[model samples]
Target: MNKSIVAGMLALALAGCASQQPEQPFTLTVAHINDTHSHFDATDARLELGNQALFTRLGGHPRLQSHAESLRRQAEAADQPLLFVHGGDAWQGTGYFKLNQGAMNADILSRMRLDAMALGNHEFDLDNERLAAFIGGVDFPVLAANLDASRDPHLSGLENLRPYVLYEFDGHDKERLESMDDAGDDPVVAVIGLVLEDMAEISPNLGELIFEREVLAAQRTVRALREQEVKHIVAITHLGLERDQRLAKEVNGIDLIVGGHSHSLLGNFSNLGWDQNEPYAQVFTNQDGRGKTCVVQAGQYAQAMGRVSVTFTPDGRVSQCDGGNTLLSDHAFFRDIRRAEQHRLAGQDAARVAAFIEAQPNIALVEEDPALRAHIDEQYKPALDRAYGEVIGHVPVELKHVRLPGADGQGSRVAPLVAASQLYWANTPAVQAVTGRRADFALVGAGGVRNSLEPGELKEGHVSLELLPFANAMSIVSLTGRQVAGLLLEAINGTLPEGAHTGKFPYSAGLRYEFSETSKGRGYLSRIEHLADGRWQKLDPQAGYQVVMTSYNASGNDGWNTLYTAQQVLTDRLDLAFVDGRLTAFPVARLSKASGGGTQVHYINQPLECNAEGVRCNTDAQAFIDYVRDQRPVLTELTPATVTLNRL
Candidate 1:
């Protein structure tokens, strides 16, 4: 009775076996850069040849152009789809950035022709209007999915930026979709963007614009892309390698993350053999705990451009992922890469391939883009020469400014001196002549100082780029001795971010203090003395004192709210402040505006121009310049620093 049924089942099984279609492999290649940070041209760097060392320039807009074009050609020859992605932070960190305010970067990167980029924290360095202007300029999509910028007039009406973008593969057909046809086989890739969440903490200009958590935003963006039947989601993020690693662990559906902000060297490298950077791309398991995610970053300042090749099964699961950083400082690396690919495709034997690699030149010069080079050479160079070439002063030895281990007491000694420089700015007769009140001490933050100086030369350019790249100006504020003491404690005991040091350590003027780490939380301030009557005596915590600090610190958004004099004056959290600029302590507004029409501590964003403007402001670099030029003949090396817990 079952013979006919068995025969029927056999035929059905054969039909099923014959109808099954093997999974087609989807291949994609992404060439990416992150933390481009406005160092538009290559600078001199130590490069490693096979067995020799050479100092040469590496990376600039032009080299990137030529290399990327070569990469595109290679990808096409290999029959792989190629994408160019940027991970963000193309703002700040150079004289070009200061002079042009990211205009050059926007122009240069646009010329490089990016497909997508995430919004970096530094993009908000300027006002929203400026950021909107930048967004208006980029031809490719500028993406930030965590925040809703539609309500902000400064960011709304921008056509170039969006939450996500869909990039259809080369063979995509519009005719297939227009006919109401069931063409579910379109090769569409979705790229989502994520901006860093700590913008409010790092810079305060974001102002009332709220950012959603990264995981939630990612989930929603992925869901939306899935709804549109888009597979192979790539999250281009400005959240740095550390955050990106956490993201890979937490989020699903993202095949890759091209990241920035920490300026991490991900994957492979060439150079003096920077051995510390992570391999060009790090692989992690997928969210379902089965598939894989590849995370890559192009080192900051365009030192390298990363290329990642990913293969996905037709069902949108990752199959093979290979990536490494291209050290643009040396074109030889890229040439070898091309050669290796050519040989592999040509079926060259391993011995022949190794011989070919050995025969390749160790050093290859990167050709400059002529027109851009001329503009930089003739125009930008001349401008820099005029402004920064002047010898401002000399230093006996290199002023110590390099960041040390977190436990090191002298994290950045020049930072303390930068703090001391503020005293010279505010205590001048100009302030007494105009405001009738002069500042007694000043605060300089260690985090704001960017570079260290060498022993030989001290140009205005040195002060400009190293000391004041951020262009933060002075803010005069009022504080009591207790407030000052509390500020120091805030700097020393502020909550450290994950894998970050406490950057708010105050470098002071006209005062010295001592405290112990063991006794910090129990009672941090052991003794704080100020120079009174030319003698170092106990600082009166109750006595009112005038203080000057950079507006970056005064904004109360530098992750050191307790250091803000307003918090001490009003005894309330910064988040509780209203538009009226008063703190609501115990649900009551207690802050009274100073006589000059600002906060109780008198918030002034302008440079201190006492005679002409009544009040004045001095940028950090300018203050360093004026102080070194006028009072100090030679900047000297640091005296040995006792540990902070011993003496701060």
Candidate 2:
């Protein structure tokens, strides 16, 4: 053979060997969202930057939709395979979603093309049947690994929806498939969905028709998916970041965990900095134990979208994973409400979405029920109307329950007046005379004053939902003065300075306290004095004295745990007993008979005391007017005056 022929053959063999080598790895992108608690509009007024205020910009559904579209387009143009997924809590919160019962929001989400979502606890706020209707309304799969929806006849039909889904795709950048060496490699991916177990306790209404198991249910599902040769596993969890980190550390087959629930805007897999009470996890690992699983949540509402990109080798493990959270609101910019309003008004003539909602079908009651709802409305509506509209005293102008910083601010008048009224009602001879048989102390939480009245022309028949939206009726409960002070201290300690002064402290008809607004939460109540000896005195926490307060305060609704331990000796009284009745029942032609006629607020110089137990009070007033009306037969009065309001 010739030497030239041998050399040409060797060159041909080398070229063929180089062409047989493996190609570059394929890349995958997962776009996730969670805890979008129906923050459809920009409601939060106080915002700076980087904080939750960023949400105020792109929080709306329209802005969020536009952002998602742009990102999807960008990913497609880049030749990347993008998957859109949601962790859970797609609805509830705010008057918008609550009034509509999630129907409109669900429609918007369906248009958003959410590929998959986990069933959140808020979904059940409308109950089982409505949830079934909502699930049917959405095109995407709502998966919950441990939810046993078998008992709900409306949900049992969805048994085909698996706890996890396995997707096998030809790995290629959607834009430039030809640029990648392993563009045609097929990789199998498993996506599992997990719901928080505590949802059963917190959102009992949503989970009442179903039961949730722990992470073990997810483990079993992952094992099954792995058995089918699906190696790249991603768990869309509604169990929050802590549980997600814990699951990643404990679970063996999970490749990555997309977390939701405890709405933290997580950017990386490290220490969670915002929460101070608990220790942060040092590190979080992926399914392979050695690798790290990227966990993230896009805060609440559709404020932002999570973008995660990971490269995978021919084997079932992940390779270079890189991505960052995108603040979509940066472009939408909802901060300038005036600008948004202009834009929104300009777009009002635009075409509406082409969708139809069928008329609601009503279910007829099978049993003949008594007029319970009517009875409740009839019993409570008048009391609410009188409390909101009736003129308790002769005010120079109208006063409102809430106040803003300005000349028009009347919260001061309303607060002091109401405080004085409750104090007088509790200690009046009639109230004291009935102490052994009924509530001795009357209390009111500040948040209960749902709405405020306007100056001038405030008239009758005005009170409605705005007056008391929470359905929290005024109530009276008996407690010792020591217990009362302890409760107040606890509230003052837990509340912000402003909140402690205006809303945290329980208002009582028999007690008074002088607090400084500049003091920190715990030290806010610098001097607490009760009215006695025609004067005020410092309060002692150990002394026992009878007291009365509102039901919300006594029942521990607003972090008032101290009240719960105060020994509830009495309750179940009409909300208007002391204040409304006193203002209206006064005989005509008398000074106290006129509106604003009851105990007027007058700041005192020192503290006051009352009772044999040496109970004391540190407050702005020395004496509270007693309106007991002889403590015998309960005096009843009816008035025609009422107040009205528009809640928006």
Candidate 3:
């Protein structure tokens, strides 16, 4: 009587077990933005006039917000969980952010509703104090797993920012169809932020207070999330693509990595159906023994927005995935040629959200007031007066882009001119106020010259700082003529990479030399030459020559490690002191006088000397300065000007 009943009950129990199997599929969407360098304004009307209609508009927070909004809407319609994130560099770039230390940009950015953001290197461009002021009211959390914020007095309060956040979303039930759509299981999405460790070295002044950590921080963060039972993890990274990939490969449990810093336009690394053929390529993962990790980054300046859609089963394994990126600047009506694409992208009616970023009210913290701007712009007499001296001669116009004599395409043209003036000024009465002696040899590094004088009618006070604009100190160093020749050779033969050649190396107005690009080793600089009488002559390696140069050069910053190798006959004299006591007195009058009437510069290929006897064949005054001003035209002086130096 009991056997049939017992068997029926067992059968019912087995069927119930089969019906309880876990759900096998789920979908999530990720929207990534990076490197929005505080460009607030939109297009200019003048740019809209001509052929400007052909190009695409680019960058503005509002455009990015709009793109993000569009992505969110699509995700919501598709019944997917949407996560909006940033890769970093939400700091200084334009007059807007720089004017307020990112306060202005942050105010606008906070309103965009980002879930999480990584810290880019430029975030440290402002001191900790300004950084705090800038990010004080940010709504969303910033994740920087690598920055040791405790050491910095200015950044000490940043410890409150969460290192990562696990977002929980309830998925809608597909079974319930339209009516029961609200019923679903809760899913945990973990997001971690990371910054590069090299920020300290790259941005010394801004990061002086904090030290950066490395991959271990990321590893620890992932482990912590794992402990919290969160399996789906996304890393918001500003450590660059290479490092991001390495992190993905080394760390287990990282589901996706959104990267920045290299300004790359990536989609999916493999054929996950993302944009594979475009110039923009998304970096993928080691595939967890399967295929690609989901890595994506929109290019810099909010020019594009990246989207990744992933299908994950209840088993925590991603089943199927597909995604694409939309170019914010490629839409119609934004193609005005005369207008700046940035402004148009920010238009109120644009597809993306409008960025209502306002200028900082505390102007004193950002830039000088109008009066100060005018003071520096119209009449910088006090600053200039405290720099150089009374009028000497006068330049009819500013002499920009000066180079060393003879060292075609390799040496500096402007440095030599300033060095010449400083050395000449040292031989006068005002010199006693500083070193109490006339200058010997002058040396100026390539990095010192910040601006070039645009060709125009030179005027008094014009020479004031139309040339130099840095903390560079004018200095006098004693060098054997042989040492001077070696320094000149090193300055001419730079060690730049393959494609990074700028005509910014080389010596100043007084020096010159030649270089061979194809030669092995330091052969980049060849047959040494200098300006003497009215022609170009060979540099005598044996003679002891005194030269005036910048302190930076002597310290070896611009690939001039060879300079200090020679005997340090003497140094540490303050060239700024000379500039102060002598040059600062006359300001306008001194600048004009020093320019002197027109100096006729010429170039002669006739080669001459290295010895005291060969001095007779030197180039003329105008030829010498001309040779030093720009080696491009002095082709025949030293080595050919076409032998280019590449940057590594």
The most accurate candidate by lDDT is 1
Candidates sorted on TM-score, descending: 1, 3, 2
Candidate 2 per-residue C-alpha lDDT over 412-443 given as tens digits, one digit per residue, 9 for 90 to 100? 33444444445565455554454333333345
The numbered model that scores best in TM-score is 1
| Error at 433, model 1, angstroms | 3.8
Model 2 TM-score, all chains together: 0.52
Against the true structure, candidate 3 has what lDDT? Answer: 0.51
Off by over 4 Å in 2: 1-24, 42-56, 159-162, 171-185, 206-210, 268-283, 286-288, 330-648
Expressed as tens digits, the lDDT of each residue in 1-648 for candidate 1 is 599999999999876643332247778889998877777777445434444343445787677777788777787777667889999988877777777786777777888878888999889877778888888888888988897776777787677778887765653121112111233434667778998776666765664356778988997888777766566788899886778888888887788888887777765344444455677567788678975788888777776778898888877888888867766643333123223444232233434333433453322345666766676676566665666666777766556564322444455657767767777766666534434556766676766776566555578877876457775556566678987787777766663334343455566666777656554232376788776566777878789877777766765545556544355344321111112322111121223323212233332232222223222222567778878788765886434442245421
Of 2 and 3, the candidate ahead on lDDT is 3
Rate residue 303 of model 3 by lDDT. 59
For candidate 1, the TM-score is: 0.76
List candidate 3 stretches off by more than 4 Å. 1-22, 43-56, 157-160, 171-185, 206-213, 267-283, 287-292, 318-322, 330-643, 646-648
Of the two candidates 1 and 2, the one with more favorable lDDT, higher being better, is 1
Error of 3 at 626 (Å): 20
Report the error of model 2 at residue 248, Å.
Answer: 1.4
Model 3 C-alpha lDDT per residue in residues 1-648, reported as the tens digit of each score: 599999999999866643332355657788888877664432211112122323234545666666666666776676668888889987644434423446666676776778778877677654567677655668777787766666556676663355776666654211211111232346667788888764532442443344446578877887776665554678899876667767767766666788888666664322212234333334355535643456667766665677877766665565655665554442434444433556355454443212111121100001112332343334332444444333334333334443332233444335555555545544446443645554443455543453344333322223332233222344454456676656555655543322111222554434554455554324545565555664656667676555555544544434554544442232332333222123321111000101111111111222211122313211112222332333322112222332233322
